[model samples]
Target: MRKFIQSIMLLALSAQLFAQSSDWVYATMTHESALSLQSSHPSGIVILATEGNVSAVQIQHQLAPSLKSGNLHGPGYIYRTDAQDAVQALTKNAPKKFNILDFTITEDMFVNEVLGMVSQENLGNTILELENYGSRFHTTSSGRQAALDLKEKWQEMAQAANREDITVELFQHQLTQQRSVILTIPGTEVPNEIVVIGGHLDSGDWSLQTNAPGADDNASGIATMTETLRILLAKNFHPKRTVQIMAYAAEEIGLVGSNEIATQYNNQNKNVVAMAQFDMTNYNGSSVDVGLINDAQFTSSELNLFWVELMEHYNSTGEHRITYGTTACGYGCSDHVSWTENGYLASFPFESSFGEHNPFVHSEEDTFAAMNNDASHSVKFVKLALEFVIEIAKVSTMSTQELNKTDIQIVVQNRDLIYQFNSSNKSLNSMAIYDSSARNVLSKNQLNASGRISLQGIPSGYYIAVFKDNQGKSHSKKFLLK
Candidate 1:
């Protein structure tokens, strides 16, 4: 009878695991009736343990409808859970002893993405910044001067190197008193719909005195975009959407510079598809995996699908764990927030476990060697990031497209507002519009798949409409009338 009971338990366990549902009870172990109560059976490593009891029960019974929902405790546990049937069968006749032991569980784990430029050839060019960064990471005239130097070098290359394909512009923001370097790769067919990738070029020491090289802080991100540009240029991949890459100024001063551009796009209602922040992508050895710190406002099913699929991809391809960090809509610790808060699928990726903790950061020693490590871990981080970009920047259905206020008049009879877009590409799937003043007016409903949106019943005012293409790209336009 005892042997029969054990067999029945095994069968029940198998059924529960196959379903992988949290709607029923699932127990790890119980003193009263675990088949192995008498002797130990091989099980997953005990990352979570009980203090005094030889055995403990992890009963996962449903509570009130409002208590909570999903996976035993969500994706935060290490071991696989037992099938619900197994829990039910064992608990059916178990005494009170089975329900009383103290227990614990492990916290969620995830993989990290290395975001900076670290390719071998680019690595050769980037390492020069480590040796030549003038030994300081301040927003000094020296720093701005360094930025100027980059512009000059690239300008010379764009002309003499016969590389006019890459146009680099320096924008000195009048409002924020900061500098912005915008790089554009105009689309061959769809030149208006835009796809933008950005990183803050500013680096800083927390003390604001010492010269922190900020190699990993952002040089990594800058390098990645630059190298990514080089790769795309070499491949001659003509995206249906125009691509814009930016190196923002004053990021260390609390993302002020990026905020200027983000807010600019926000105000104009520029068509923006997906904006990504590639900060601190190199030199982390911690086991913690990549972080997808996304704001909650987007709640777009498409955005949610991207994150879920991205993490699932990492779990299958690598050994690290990946997870979502926060739940609130207005919470994020990186430059992506500027885009996220304005209704874009903005996000930042981090590799280190304690996100805001960098011991050598903001110091002269925050050089390439500090985070540009070549450990096995580093290799995975680099590969994961590179692959992620390759996948993300490959939107193909329609290039970003933006229409002028005149175009808006032709489409809608409201005749009450003016529309303007940074660029409206000739393609279909992606686009964005910035309403420098009326950004919050667009989320009328779930416009996730609304190809041709209507703005009826809306108060007459200037507005920007940003259309993000379905195929991983975006475009924007401004509107005005009456």
Candidate 2:
């Protein structure tokens, strides 16, 4: 009851800041990047601060009650768009990125404090940032120019880091600045089919601030996403499908990064299966105590709920109460929105309660202290987010009906079954057929829209038909020859 009341108080205290939409937030972020060209050691110093411990299921569980309560101020509004922009957001965009300011600050504070770098000596100025982006173009030309300039600064910083031993160089996809990172623990029979876990690395601005250190805005997000990647990688268990972890870029600037990569795969029409986003998973507002709470409360129906259900495979957090699609919300700010917009079933793991939203996002204040913390189960929080990405996001979940709608359809001639299209999900496209040892069969081939082409002659016998679907989904069924 005390916690619930505290949550109400926090909401009442921060009502002014939490009312804005993500669209406004993105522009505000770019404004900050444009204003201050900080030289924080390496370019995109955001890359250097990675704790690799955000995936903790226990942590995720402890935060949900707060998430349910903090959703009041957020109405989960929707955005109206023209056909062109919708197409781009949903299809053409790919290669997203995840922000990690919260983790960075906490990790840095701890590391430095332990290293004896406390108040003794002066630490340099930290580059503050904020984010509310979904494909760089969502805002305006001003935002674009700002992003371009920020990129230039980061490039300069990254180049400088290259000269230093502390820098770890990684490739960024040319179009969206996205990086492809895959984690695979070999599958038993189908090592080719994969379950991908991912998040975009970027931030948005609501307005222009001189310093925009997106600590809670998304630094927390990337921290959780990366931590999830690390946990899955550390596990020795192998599943039926390979699990790939992708940290996308250009998410804040616009869902540009993830959209780019996802669209490319969509164009190829491969089975990307499902996608999940760890956007703002660090903050847990006050409404944690479930016993007492009035009608006025905040709630979050983001990707975390799905994650909670997914965790049932392991052991913990069995029930939750919130699941709103990105479209259900007004705008697509985070990278998961990119996947959802593109017609893919993607999830976003946002903060528990955004009531005490990050006031310092676009300013220099987006550091760790400005947001809420569940405190009890931080690691669990991170783990639940990833569990959803791995299980719910897997390709095998798709049904046979979804397969026929793709570029490839089932084709059968005589005793031969063939797949006539390409897809990323290997399980759906795995070929299956049955035939008797004494049966005589004729030749077969996949024709145009007509489907299967049979040879002139064939023998009567029982046989099974098999073929791959558009998303690389495969299926088989038995047939009686007459």
Candidate that would win on lDDT:
1
lDDT of 2 at 356: 42
The TM-score of predicted model 2 comes to: 0.42
TM-score of each model, paired residue for residue: 0.50, 0.42
Candidate 1 residue lDDT tens string, 296-342: 33222233334334443344232444433322212224566556545
Model 2 over residues 209-292: C-alpha lDDT tens digits?
224445555555545544443343333223445555555555544445565666566667545445555554444443431111
Q: Lowest summed-lDDT stretch of 10 residues in model 1?
A: 98-107
Off by over 4 Å in 2: 1-188, 204-210, 286-308, 311-328, 353-359, 371-377, 389-482
Q: What is the lDDT of residue 332 in candidate 2?
A: 33
- lDDT of model 2 at residue 110? 16
In terms of lDDT, model 2 sits at 0.35
The numbered model that scores best in TM-score is 1
Off by over 4 Å in 1: 1-118, 127-131, 135-139, 153-165, 175-178, 295-315, 318-332, 372-482
Error of 2 at 253 (Å): 2.0
